[model samples]
Target: MLIAKVYITLKKGILDPQGKAVKGALYSLGYEEVKEVRVGKYIELTFEDGDLSLLKDKVDEMCKKILTNPIIEDYTFEIVEG
Candidate 1:
């Protein structure tokens, strides 16, 4: 079996209003040291054993097609085998 950890985030130069809100809330709650906050998504996936290369390719395709929006977001994943 293999485990995949995926991270999805907005591309650079994209505005993140939710992150900004969180930063503001933190600052109001006495977290003045907080500078910027960016929100992202994390996903964990498990797959049956297969060729590592093929598994990686499938995961990449899944990320591009469904896990993230190609125009507004970027994603990367790490695969762990067991």
Candidate 2:
């Protein structure tokens, strides 16, 4: 079996509204030590076969097509054998 882990995040020039809101709320609650915050998505997928290359391609395609918006987000993934 294989496991695929994917991470999705906003692009460098894009603003993360949710993250900013959380940071602001933290500061309001007296958490002044928090400098910055960014929110992202994590996905885990399992495949029956231990094919590293094919699994990687499948995960990458899934991220590009469904997991993230190509214009505003960036993604990376890793595949491991189980």
Q: After TM-score superposition, what is the CA distance of residue 48 in candidate 2 from its true location, in Å?
A: 1.1
Per-prediction RMSD in angstroms? 1.3, 1.6
For candidate 2, what is the TM-score?
Answer: 0.83
In candidate 1, what are the lDDT values of residues 1-82, reduced to their tens digit? 8999999999988999999999999999999999889899999999988889998999999998899999999898999985
- Clashes (backbone N, CA, C under 3 Å), per candidate, total 0, 0
Off by over 4 Å in 2: none
- Highest TM-score, which number? 1
Tens digits of per-residue lDDT for model 2, 3-77: 888888999878999999999999999999998888999888888986677777778889989889999999988
User: Pick by lDDT: which candidate is best?
Assistant: 1
**Global local distance difference test of model 1:** 0.93
Query: In candidate 2, where is summed lDDT lowest over 10 consecutive residues?
Result: 50-59
